[model samples]
Target: MDSGQGCVGLSGRRNRCRVTDSASVAVSGRPREAWIDVAKGVAITLVVLYHAVMYLDGVGLAGAMAPLNPLLDTFRMPLFFFMSGILAATAIRLPYWQLFRKRMSLLLYLYAVWVAAQTLFLLALPPISPDGPNASWTNLVTLFIRPSSNLWFIYALPIFLTVAWLTRRWNPLIPVAVTGVLAVLFGSQILHTDTPWDKMGRYLVFFLAAIWLGPRVRRMVPHIRWWHMAVVCGVYLGIVLIMVKLSLTRVPFVLLFVSILAVLVGVSVAVVVARAPGFDFLRVLGTQTLPIYLVHTFPMTALAAVLMATGVSLPTVAATALPVLLCSFAIMFALAAYRRLAAVPGIFTVPVASWVDTSAVAQRAEQAEASA
Candidate 1:
C-alpha cells in the first residue's frame, strides 16, 4: 500500500457521516478522517493482495490469481496517493524545516532502513523464488538513481512532498498542468524508465490534484450521489476492460485518462463504503497500512521459504484463496509486530534530532515569513 505507505494512520469508519473540512477531530493520537482511512484500507488491501498472489505464484503456490493483477493495477496506488494528498493539504502549509522534520525526514528514513532490511533479508535467506535485483542488494548502490524495492512508494513520497511545497505559492493550476502533462508523458512509457520512477511520474498528478482540491473535496464527498458513483465507476470499469483487452492503455495518454477516471471511481467507492456496514474492517486496516506495507512482503518471504521447504502443493481452490488468506495474515502479522516493536524508536518514524540539513530550509521559511 505504500499508500500515503495504508495511510501509514489508523481509523475505524463512521456511520455514513459526511466529512467536512472543519472536522479535525483526533483519532488514536493522530488527526484523521475515517473515510480517508477507509479509502486507504481499500487501496492497501489491493496492494497486499497483489503481492500475496505474486509471491505465492512465484514459488508455484498459486497461479489463478494472476488476472487480478491487471484488473486492479490502475486504481489502487492512485487512490493511495489521492488520499495522501487530501491529508497533506495542512502539512504542505508548514514551514519547510518543519515540513522536513515532520514529513519528509521520516519518509526517507523508512525507505533507507527498509531497503537495507530487504537487502539483508534477500542475502541471508534467499527466496526459493528469487525476485531479482529489486529485493536484493544488487540495486543498493543505484538506489540514488532509481529505487529498486517495493518500498519505492516511500522513496517517492518525499519527492512529491518537496515539489508540492516548493510550488505552494504558485497558481495551483501551474503545478497541476505541468505534472499532468508529465504524468501522461511518463505513464505512456514514451520516456520509459525504472518501474518505481515511472510510477512516481505517472502518479504525481493525482497527489497534486488532491492537494489543490483540498477541502473542496471533503465538502463534495458527502454530497456525492449514487448515480454519480454508478455512471463514473461503470464507465471507468468498461473503459479499463476495453483498453486492457485492446492493449491500448499505453496508446499515448490513454492510461492518464483511465487513471483519472479510476480516481473518480475511487471517490465514489469510498463514499459508498463509508456509509455501509460489514466493511468496518477496511477502515481499521487503513490505519496500519504503513507498517504493513513496509513489512508485509517480509512475511511473504518467510511464508514462501516455509512453503518451499515443506514442498507443500496447494490445490486450485486453495490457490484461488491464498491471496485473501495471505493478505489477512500479512495485515495481522504486520500490526502485531508493529505493536511489539512500538517501544522502539526510529522503527516506524525518524529518530528525533537527527540533522538532515533541514535548518537551511527553516531559515529560508523564516526569511519568507519576515519578508512577507
Candidate 2:
C-alpha cells in the first residue's frame, strides 16, 4: 500500500497531514497520526489471524476451532485494500516518473524477490503437493500470469498504481464507474482467473474510491456513529442467517453486496478502535506489517509441519491462536535482528534511483514556479 509516510488523523475534521520523512513512519521513525497506524495495525493483525486459521484447518491442526468464522472471511482483505486505497491518494499528485519509480517499481521488486524466495522454500520443503513445479527461471515468468501463491498482494499493487496514475487527471466519477464495472465483472466471475488480477478487479474500485474521496474520508470516519456499526453488524448477520436458512449456493451478486458492506463495516470498526486510546501495540504491529507479511509464511508452514511431525494435536481455538501469536512474535524477532544488522528493510520499501529522471524534476519545479 502506501509507503511509510505521515498520515492525517482519520477522526475529526483536520487538514491532510504533510508527508516528508523518507523512511517508514508506520512504526517508529518519526511520530505521526496514531490512528492510521492503528487501522493498519488492526488490518494486518486480522490478516495474520485469517491465514493462521486457514493453515491450521488445512493441516487438521484446529481440533475445536470450528470452521473459520464465515463472517471474517468476508472483510479481511477488503480492509487492507481499503486502507491501501486511502494511502494511494498521495500518489495521484506525484510526477509520472516519480510515481512509476517510487510507487510502481517498488511493488515489482518486492513481488519478484519474494516470488523467488517462496519458490525456493516450496521446492525445498516440498509440501503435500509432491507434483509441484521445480524451482526454475520459468517460474519467474509465471509470476506475471500466476498469483505467486501467498504473495499475490504484492503482485497486485503495481497494477493498481499504474491504473490509478493513468486516470489521475480524469473526472473522479469516470474511474469510479469503470472500477465499479470491473468489480461487478470480478464478482460475477466473468473475468475469472487464478491470478491476483481476479482480486484486482474486485479491489481496484476501493483504491480508486479512496483517491477520489481523498481528505473527505478523514473527516467522515469520525462521524461513523454507533448506529452505523449496529446496522453494519445487523446486515451482515442477517445475510449469513438467511444464506444458511435458504441453503442456496452463494451468488455473485450476493457476494458483491456483502463484500461492499463488509468493507464499510471494517472501516467503521477501525475508526472506533483508532479513537480508543492506550493501544500502542497495534501501531507497532501496523508499522511492521510488510516485513511480517513476507516472513510469516515460513513460520506458519513450519509450525504446522512441526505439529504434524510430533503428532501434537491442538483444539481448533488453540490451533488457530497459537500459530498467529507465535508467527507474529517470530517475525518480530526476525525483524529486530534484521534491523540490528543495519539492513535496509527492502521488505517495507526500496528506492529505484536508476529510474530517476534528474531533468524531469527540475523542469517540473520550474514549471510550478512559473505558474505560481
Candidate 3:
C-alpha cells in the first residue's frame, strides 16, 4: 500500500483528503467524492466482522454462520487489495528509492512488529492448540523469509511493487496472463511449498491484476451508469448466494472474476453516492481504516473471550454476528479517536526524514517562470 506521504506533499492539510480527491477526479471528474470512501469503509468492516465471528465460533461460544460468511468473503479482500493498488498507482510515479523508503519500508516495519507482538502474545498465553499444527521453529524461520498467515499480504506487497516497476513498460496483458497462470497453478494445488516465493506466487495474481487494471478501471468510471451498476451488484449477489447455498469449497477461483466485477461496482456506487449529498460517516470510517485494520483484532478477541466467560452461547447465527459487528465498529471508532488525538504535534507522529526528490515541484516552478 502507498504510504500517507504518497497521498500528498508536506502541505498543512492531510494528504489522505488530497488522495481521495484525486481518486474521485479519476472516477467522475469530481474532487473529494464520498462514496469511494464508503466502499472502503464497508470492505474493512466486513474483514473485521469475518475475523471476529471466526474467533468466537472457534471457541464454541458461537456456531458457524457459514452461508453469510462465505458470501461476505467474496469481496472483502478483493476490494482491499484493489484499493491498495489504486493508491499505489499514484505512488508508482515516484523515484524507485523514494518508493522503497516510503511504501516498502513501512510494510516491512509493520510486519516485523506485528509478528513479534503475535509471537509474544502466543507465548505468554495458555497453549491453546492452533487450527493446524503448531508452527515449528523451522516454519517460523521460513515465515520470516516468506511470511504466511494474514500478514503475508504485507510481506508480499514489496515483491508485487517491484514486479510492477520492472514490467511497467511491458504490455499490461503480459503480466495479467503470467499472473493468471500462476494463480491457476496455486489454486489447483500444483505449486505446493512453504517457501515465501511459493506463497507470493499464489497471491501475486490479484495484486498484479490490481496494478495492471488500475488505469483501465479509472477510465471506465464515466461509462458506468447507475442502472448498469445496479445490475452488476444484483448479479454479484446472486452468484455469491448460490455458491454459498451449494456449499462451495474452492469458490475463490470462480469468485475471482466476480470480485473484479464487484470492485467496478463498488467504484461506480462510490461515484454516484459521492455526487449526492451528505454521508459523512462513510468518509470518517474510510479515513480510519488503516488504524482499524491494525487494532480491531484486540477488541474483537476480547469480546469473544468475554462472551465465552459469561457462558453465552452464540448458538443462533444472529447472536454470533451481532456482537462481532458491534465490537468491530466500537474498536474502529476508538482507534479513529486515538489517531485523531495522536495527530497533534510531537505526540504520536513519527518524524522520519524522507529522501524523496522534488524534481516535479522544481519542474512545475520552472515551467511557471518560463510562461511568465
Tell me each candidate's RMSD, in Å, in order: 6.7, 6.7, 5.7
What local distance difference test score does each model get?
0.71, 0.60, 0.55
lDDT per residue as tens, model 3, 142-234 = 556757564666667676777777777788789878887776565445675755455466556666677667667667766767797788789
Tens-place lDDT per residue, model 1, 109-201, is 777888888777866764457554325455677775779547888778888888889999999999999998998888778878766888888
Residue 204 displacement (Å), model 1? 0.6
lDDT of 1 at 170: 95
> What are the clash counts of all predictions, listed in order?
4, 5, 0
The alpha-carbon lDDT assigned to residue 133 of candidate 1 equals 34
On TM-score, the leading prediction is 1
Candidate 2 clashes between residue pairs 3 or more apart in a chain or in different chains: 63-315, 63-316, 64-315, 64-316, 65-316
lDDT of 3: 0.55
For model 1 the TM-score comes to 0.85
